[model samples]
Target: MALKINKTAVKEAKAGDKPQELRFEDGLILRVQPSGVRTYYVEVARGKRVRIGRVGTVTPAMAAEAAKRLSVKVMGEGVEAVMPVRAITLEKFIADVYEPFVEHEHRRGKRTAEDLRRSFADLLSTKLDRITSRELDAWVRGRREDGVKAATIAREANQLQGALRFAVERKHLKVSPFDTWKAPNVPQGNVERYLTTQEKAAIRKALSDRDRQQARERASANKWRRERRYPELPMVADHVMPMVLVLLNTGMRYGEVVKLEWQAVNLTTRTITVVGEKAKAGRGRIIQLNDEALKVLTTWRALTNRTTGLVFQCDGEPIKSIKTAWKTIKKMSGVENVRIHDLRHDFASSIVQRGGSVYVVQKLLGHGNVSQTMRYAHLADEQAAKAVALLDGHKRGGR
Candidate 1:
């Protein structure tokens, strides 16, 4: 029989020869053994019981409050929330708890989750307490052997360490194993590749040629469909070419461009507003569109016939990736050892080479600090020379 458990009821409860059970309204139970010892247990969910404490250790009131807290914590953080920290494995924590929480809280949570899975595949099954500095050192050494760059290795390690820190914050672990591990040093302002003038022209030509080819293919397919009395395909231009052009011209990150809504873009003002939530730095900023970018956007908008919703979408949905088209563009352009990210470096390099200030470049690229933009300072060699030349006052064949 169950009762409304209280101090008097709990105290007056007698034990039998066998274990006697006293159930309460809030899933709180007092189990009395034959020796007259009482212990508290809380049922967080169906058939899931969590031990609280003994009666002499914790009063009925204290036990009930603890039970309520346990139930609430379990409801919010899942069953692992109540489990001992050492019992949870790194993989289980990521899959069962961390991933779901981040997926709800962050825009790039899915990607972050995928990165963790791929980067730490070998360590996923290891328990949190089992992860040691020696293991991490070996992993870093292995990555170096595999020809991974120090920066790439550092980024991946930091992301994994972040997940471990989150576990500590959530009380899922006593401490993060990464707390003692030193991350690989990443060089500052190491700009790897910037497109040359000829390369840029070749890429532009490739994009234009791809668009024309797409149009021809669509036309031929539509003609066949018309002859067969089938529905004709829409002749709208694709988002890849225009999106790449926008990235190159605006120096906007791919994520920012993909999530960009029409409401954020002011065609009349020739500007784009990167929302704070979607921006990498968690702060919003405006990007002034260049003549080439403006024209590309205008043509794309006209072709798509959209004035609302996402600026670049596929079948009325936000685009996931442009990898296939990007590969084709690279092959067609005959450019070697260039990545999509290099487009942004090229944009910054061009600005500095054309006498644009570091401050202006920082603002355009939405960098958090001037130091990040200093990679292009060397590219401003000619501009720097001109500035120094002004110190001489009236350059007449070097005085």
Candidate 2:
């Protein structure tokens, strides 16, 4: 029975086995359960319900007043108007929306999403609409004051802009705070640093020295294994030399080389296919093995007992990093201001120095774009000069 629900009537009303709802004026309602618990709700529209409060905890007059106000709001603003009041926070948006979209939709790595999360920690709790460009500027300024490089800040800002755009696209936000915001400018081209021929030789000598030491250790270990000694000699460094050789030869990133499996290498074809997740570009590329690279791989493969899985392994597993080994090699080799990645640059530089076209270098290095190949264009200047010199031999009217 629909009766005007007041506090006295609410107390008097009893529910049967099923729960009962008492309707009041202006869409106010009191729901009574079989156990005699009562709760109030306001039916703003046909299918839209908004909970106000419980029967006793909130007096009937107060619920009625709230319901009346909400009814006015619904009449004036419509049912869909409550979204801003329930807008998701920045943290929720990042966790629920941005991260999933980046990892799955964008096909980006987990490291990228993690970096964005870390970079935006300061603004994680703020609402999307409340986040202003001024706030972003302050964040950039704070990052700069904290000794972070401008390039790094620029990357973080670009990530932030992407996230904001994502939010807008999903309708979680009406407009991006970064729509007109200016991110810090980073240098256009990559910082190219290639090892000189002498530097390369020094590094190779250092690696060879370590290799000799490792060989001696291996021989001793083999003797111990044959004699069935208590503990066979511990496994010495075997991966570093081969890994370094591959990096220097093929120009593969450290990640690509470390993750390389035996299946990727085809000795007959003289090619290594960097495929699937192993490639940075999300596509496969073939790396042709030079004589030196082929020799190193052949030797390493001959010595390796396990023919399957990662070509480079430490303790029968893929090696995550070569930082310590590389640091020691760099120190011993006396090659200053060169990184492991510079090996790839050196490889490209070597190709360009040998009169190889930039297009050839690009194909060899597996670069996605020619622009990435253009950084080593400076290496071709001598060849260009030589080409011009050839024209001088046929000159008849030039001064």
Top model number, TM-score = 1
Model 1 misplaced stretches (Cα beyond 4 Å): 1-190, 386-399
Candidate 1: count the clashes: 0
In TM-score terms, candidate 2 sits at: 0.52
Supply the global lDDT for candidate 2. Answer: 0.79
Q: Write the per-residue lDDT of candidate 2 for residues 40-148, one digit (tens) a residue.
A: 9988778778888776689988998888888788778887553334458888987887787777876564666766756676777888888888898878765543334
CA lDDT, candidate 1, residue 140: 78
Cα distance off (Å), candidate 1, residue 17: 58
lDDT of each structure?
Answer: 0.82, 0.79
**TM-scores, in order shown?**
0.56, 0.52
Error of 2 at 65 (Å): 45
lDDT of 1 by residue, 1-399 (tens): 546678898888899999998888667889999999999998877877888899989988888888778878987899766765545887898898889988999998988887787667678788877778987887776554323467778888888888988888877777777767777554333344888889989999999999899999999999999999999998887787899899889988776888899899898999999988888657789999989999998998898888899999878877765666877999999996666677778889889989889899898888898999998898798778988888678566476
The RMSD (Cα, Å) of candidate 2 is 12.2
